[model samples]
Target: MVIEWLTLMVPADWHERFIAADTAIWTHFLAQQPGYVGKQIWRNPAKPDELTLLIHWQSRQQWKAIAPTALAAVEQEFRQNLGRSFDIIAANEYQPLADGSISSQRPMAD
Candidate 1:
C-alpha cells in the first residue's frame, strides 16, 4: 500500500470548513478512484494552526496514475467553492513495509 502524507497550516477560524472540504474531496472524489483505500485528517493539539492528512491507496502505481488534470480540476473546485483555508507545508508519499500487510490491522483508525 501507499500513503500520502501532508502537513498544512490552517487558520483557526477556518478549521472546520477546511476539514469539511478536505473530507469531501477524499470521500466524493478520491474514494471514487480505482486505488483509493481511505484517508485520515488530524489537528495538532499544541499548534491549532497545524493540520495533517494521511491518504492510503492500494498501490503507488495506481495512486500515481490519478491524472494530474483531474486532480487540478478538483483542487480548482475546492478553491473556488470553499476558498483557501490552508497552505500545505509538507507533502510526501511512501510505500508500506515490505514485510507484509501491516496496515490491514486497523484500516482507518484515529
Candidate 2:
C-alpha cells in the first residue's frame, strides 16, 4: 500500500471552514478515483494551525496515475470554496514494509 502524507498550515480561525471544504471537495473527489483506499485528517492541539492528511492508495502507480488536469481542477475548486490559498508545509510518500512499519525513501540530491 502507498500512503500519501501531506501537512498544511491553515489559520486557526479557518479550521472549521477548511475541514468542511476539504471533506466536501477532496474526500468526495478521491472516493471516486481508482485505487483509493481511504483517508484520514488529523490535527494536533499544540499546533492547531497545522492539518495532516494521510491518504491511502492500493499502489503508488495508481495514485500517481491520477490525471494532472483532474488534480488541478479539484485544487482550484478547493481554493474557490475556501476563498484563500493554503500552504503545504510538507509532502511525502511512504510504503508499508514487511515489518509493519512505514518507510519513505528520500530522493538523492544531484
Candidate 3:
C-alpha cells in the first residue's frame, strides 16, 4: 500500500476548525478517488500545533493517478474555508513494510 504522510502546524486555537477542514478535504475529496483506503490524523502533545496525516491507498500509481485539477480544487476549498494555509512541515509518500488492512474507518466530524 501507499501512504501520504504530511506534517502540519496549525494554531492551537484553530484545532477543531482545522480538523474539520482537513477531514473534509480527505473525506470529501481524496476518498472519492479510485484507490483511497483510509486516513488517520495524529496530534503532537509536545508541540500542540503539530499534526500529522496518513492517507492510505491501494498503490502508489493509483494514488498518483488523482487528477491535479481535482486536488487543486480541494486545496482551494480548504484555504477558502479555513482562511489560512497550514504550515506544512513534511509531505511525502511511503510504502509499508507489510501491506495491512484497516478494520474500521475514522469517524467523520459533524
Candidate 4:
C-alpha cells in the first residue's frame, strides 16, 4: 500500500474555518476518490498553523491514475473557497512497511 502525506499551514486566526473546510474536503471530496482507502488529520499544538494529512491508497499506480482529476477538484476547494486562509505544502508519498507500522523504519524514497 502507498500513503500520501500532506502538510498544510493555515493562519492561526483562521483555524476554525480551516478545520471546517477540511471536514468538507475529507467527506465530500476525498471520500469519493478511487483507491482511497482512508485518511487521518493531525493538529500541531506547538504551531497553530500546522496541519498534517495522511491518506491511504491501494497502490501507487491507482493513486497516480486518479490524482489529476481528484486533485483538480481539491485545488478548486483550496483556491476558490479556502485560498486566502492557508498555505499549502507539498505532499509526500511513501511506501509503507510490511508490518503496517508507520515507524521511523519506514523507507522514504530518495
The number of the candidate with the highest lDDT is 2
lDDT minimum window of 10 residues, candidate 4 = 97-106
lDDT of candidate 1 at residue 34, scale 0 to 100: 91
Give the poorly placed runs of model 4, Cα more than 4 Å off.
Answer: 67-70, 83-85, 100-110
Per-residue lDDT over 1-110 for candidate 4, one digit per residue giving the tens place of the 0 to 100 score:
89998888866777777767777775467667678788887878997778888888898887788667667768677656766645668689988666655673657799
For every candidate structure, what is the RMSD over all alpha carbons to the true structure, in angstroms?
Answer: 5.9, 8.2, 8.3, 6.6
Instruction: Return the TM-score for each candidate structure.
Output: 0.82, 0.86, 0.84, 0.72
Q: Compared with the true structure, what per-residue lDDT tens digits does model 2 show for residues 1-110?
A: 99999999987888899989999999999999999999998997999999999999999999999999999999999999988899999999999875433455555699
- lDDT ranking, best first: 2, 3, 1, 4
Instruction: Provide the overall lDDT of each model, using Cα atoms, as 2-decimal numbers.
Output: 0.84, 0.93, 0.86, 0.75
| Models ranked on TM-score | 2, 3, 1, 4
State how far residue 35 of model 4 sits from its true place (Å): 1.0
With candidate 2 superimposed using the best TM-score fit, by how many Å does residue 96's alpha carbon deviate from the native? Answer: 1.3
Residue 21 alpha-carbon offset, candidate 2, angstroms: 0.6
Per-residue alpha-carbon lDDT of candidate 3 for residues 13-98, written as tens digits (9 for 90 to 100):
88899889878775778878899999998888998988888999999999999889888888888999988888789999898885
